[model samples]
Target: MIPQGPGEEDYGALSEQRKLVLATYDLCAVCALPFRDELRWQVTFDDQLQQMGETFAFNEAPVHEVCALYAAQVCPFVSSPHARLGDAQRKGQRRAETLTLAGFTHTATVFGHDSELQVGESILMFEMADLRRIHRLTGADDARSAYEAVLRDEARIELDDAERRVVDLLCAPTPKGEDSGPVMAGAAWFIGAVFCPQIRRVQAMKKFADAEGDLYFQLAANFLDNPEMMAEWEDSNDASTAAAMSWFRTRQSVPAVLQQWRADGARRVRDVRGRRPRAVGAAVVVPRDEAAIRRRRDAEAALRKARRRKR
Candidate 1:
């Protein structure tokens, strides 16, 4: 490698080839330590860990084993047979200690605290490649963390706004007698079951049907999860899940909410036409002209004749 002049020091930055060589050596040095405190060291595995490079202190068998395991955990790729080369060429290879330090620094930037493992109680360092290895060993850490967070009251508070938004969206008047099951399932119900309950609580207080003229169908669906609750709600009859959730305030009260949503939909359809006109031309209007009138009259007459024939 050409040494850089004092004026152009940055120009001699390590090439990709040099970087790889350094990284491999770094992996080897870390593999030299016996990271496992009490575990027996297998001779073959220890040799494999070093990739048959220079051995560490003769008396430090345990230390060597620990180092080897830590190296393996950090970078298994370097120990591969394909990469190990002849002794004559390897003599001038980069120092493993320097490379290991660089690799350790790199890992700290990439994996953060989550990538840290129990190498020793006192030494809490993260391996750059350990993030991928850890995830592969178990499952995604983020998924597990999110699940844990979901069960917390703080999680409910965090999702409360989004939950309210979903409920509000779901409550908007849809087609009369339309099954709100799928909608509710996707919206408020899904939020509570998959996310948090505080969101449902926030939504329950908002008047949907009376003030907004929309029913809290989604909020109601969340409560209907329990069979016993569904039964009680049916026996007592309620307005919506939001109402039932508020009134009952426990897991048992959900059924009443489901019953209310069911009844509210039925009553709304019977009491009001369940449909309001779109402002004049906001929707396509089929004009009641002569042709349309004739078609309508013919259809009515045909229905009447069919009924008479059936009778």
Candidate 2:
């Protein structure tokens, strides 16, 4: 047989590598442990998390929840809720199908794989393991904060500023006899449930809020998940999730903060309404998009990590 290059030679050797026991599996990225009862796998996804009937691992490593949270916060790549990879980073092969390190899932070793398994040339093949839960870490600051708050408050479920606002908005008496949910819409609800995720603590917050507000959103969301939370919130009120998130995100600030935003929003609305064609008006160019600015900042942070990896 003709000899191939170094990369090819390594591939051939890996394809024939002997199967090893589970004890020799890869170590946890954070703790450096070979095995654990609870493990998580970071995945880069296109349309969804579980696509093509396969699960993905970030750099082929598992991590503990504590480690993952710290990484998600400090790691620029994982912190972005809408971060994307460029063609070169993706190896320039799937240019059109740009994949992002979308999220993570709880996974473990399958039954037979514990006995024996081998790594493939460029990938590892294993049976489907239990996918206990999924965490969408993109734009995860609010969600992560809520989770950490819950963890820290072991004595009692004291509502944070955001949680308190959600409960207050939910429990307020409405024109109808029953109270209504927050004003966030379906799309906004998705952002909250999947990204910001304050609604996850609705029930616990209820212990402090009230004995009522059944038709209210945060209460109903205690039992419901993403779809159910969105539907119930929309049914109770016509507000968008953005509106709800805005309230929670800024509730701690002065109450008049939203009023100032509304004033600015009103001026923008008026400008758009009154816009007219100009004979020689060159378009007034605005600065970068919010996502672009965020990407640049994150890229700097990621570059630091890359340099560390190289060292």
Candidate 3:
């Protein structure tokens, strides 16, 4: 449950502080732990899809695929077809008949400001990659199918050539005994290219540049003008990086480049931490599964203890 205020718990409303923590650390909304898998999932409604389509940015923080499926099956508001959304911010919105379980590999923080340019609200939005439709009428069965399908890796989006190139460039190891400044510049470029919307990409880049130094900004600008310089600077750099760096280095007008990559079947890829194949005969949990519920509770307790220890 999300806390609404001091000592007040709200099932429907999200805590602003919690949302920031989840976004900053890339933690799962359900387990409040770092992701172990490549994909992140979010629950969406038919009305949202109709308005924004499959690639729409989701304001809600993402959950683990398993958590999403489990919630779909067990959460009273989610599982009931006739129930309204009950979102405090948007009251009286009826729930859609079919809900979507959308998966993605990338998320970005969008900051909103007041007239004086003071930061007001920050929303963590995710890019869609894959999805499954769940019919609320069918209840647990539909949720179960979606869960099994994800576990089987069905409908998984693989990184394409362009995307793989971008990942490789961004993740390139800095040479031993060398200044990492250039590489950090590359990191800034990566953030600009992948994590920001076009409207704010330049602003994000400027912020990063200011933090690094004026020279770093100049170098980044040079890379934007002559992308081949990135390849020349590091002989190990690949042709793909050189090909893509033009738009990546220039924070301005990079969305078109991303759109082109997507058109070319590009999908984001990320490091998988502690992801291992499930053993044969492993228990597949469904709705009203007491064992699964207990396990989740245990995991949550352990996570809380670990976090407390870290503090």
Candidate 4:
């Protein structure tokens, strides 16, 4: 099951739906429309069949299907990041898969019925947007043709200089997972630096900023120096700002935060860091050799015949 948040309990100091609004600012990650139409998901995901019981989170916000596809085409992480940074830092949850590219698996919605605990009768009530899947680009030259096949019209996705730089890295291939650890740590700087992948909503935020005149940047530029204003975002009704506030309050500059992540990741051994993921349970398994099986069966039959004769 996709992540459902801390489960049934209202978080923050707000009503349920409002808490989600605070969680994801009531907007689509791709298009920034303040409403969700379809349950959006990645085109592909790591099917760790062997680790079926383990948990995975997209750790980003929701998007329109079209937007998700658009992201699949242009967005660096969706196109394919260097690695799959799972919940290795935490206990219980298994380690994530790291690869060259993360292709689009597919996008889908949940099936549910109505009730009181689920008055809305939804498995995912308010905070579904927070339940994002992490996908990535695997190979160097792969997906480039597919990426070029589509035409993009992102006039609304306005980017400041800082954001543009990040996008540039996404489009490039130098600082990939295998080539460099630090640059490719969590597929993106904001992701690597953040405590939770769910909280690192910068990809969706590029659109969210355009929808709101880059309020986050304004807040970051202004309130980052002022403790008073920063607190207001945390306490305010503007959910996106409140979400961004979590990062600001972390106190480490984004660069420093990411750098530390890289060092820690490099220092930790792979097995010690986490287990490798191989999707299992209903997963396809290779069959044993037919001739060998027949030989074994014949031998067993001969032994049984001799034993019956002796009897």
Each model's TM-score, in the order given? Answer: 0.14, 0.29, 0.38, 0.23
The best-first sequence of candidates by lDDT reads 3, 2, 4, 1
**Cα lDDT of model 2 by residue, 115-232, tens digit:** 1322321222222245555555445574467349535742333544333333333334323533232222122223222111122222222222243442333432321222223222
Alpha-carbon lDDT, every model:
0.27, 0.34, 0.44, 0.33
Local accuracy of candidate 1 as per-residue lDDT tens digits, 17-74: 1211112112122222112112222222223334424322111111122333434343
* Per-residue error (Å), model 2, residue 247: 54
Model 1 quality (TM-score): 0.14
Kindly list the per-residue Cα lDDT of model 4 for residues 1-311, writing each as its tens digit.
Answer: 87767723433111222222212222344444423233444344445422324332232344554455555556444444554545466446433332222222222211112323434322222212223334344442334543344235332445433232232322233322221112222222222222222222322222323535544333332332233444444433322233334333443233322333323333332334364322111112233446644554454355446545756
Model 3 lDDT tens row, 29-88: 775544534567777765556677555566566787777887788866446756565779
Instruction: Locate the minimum summed-lDDT window of 10 residues in model 1.
Output: 103-112
In terms of lDDT, model 4 sits at: 0.33
As for TM-score, the candidate ahead, 2 or 4, is 2
Best by TM-score: 3
Using lDDT as the measure, the top candidate is 3
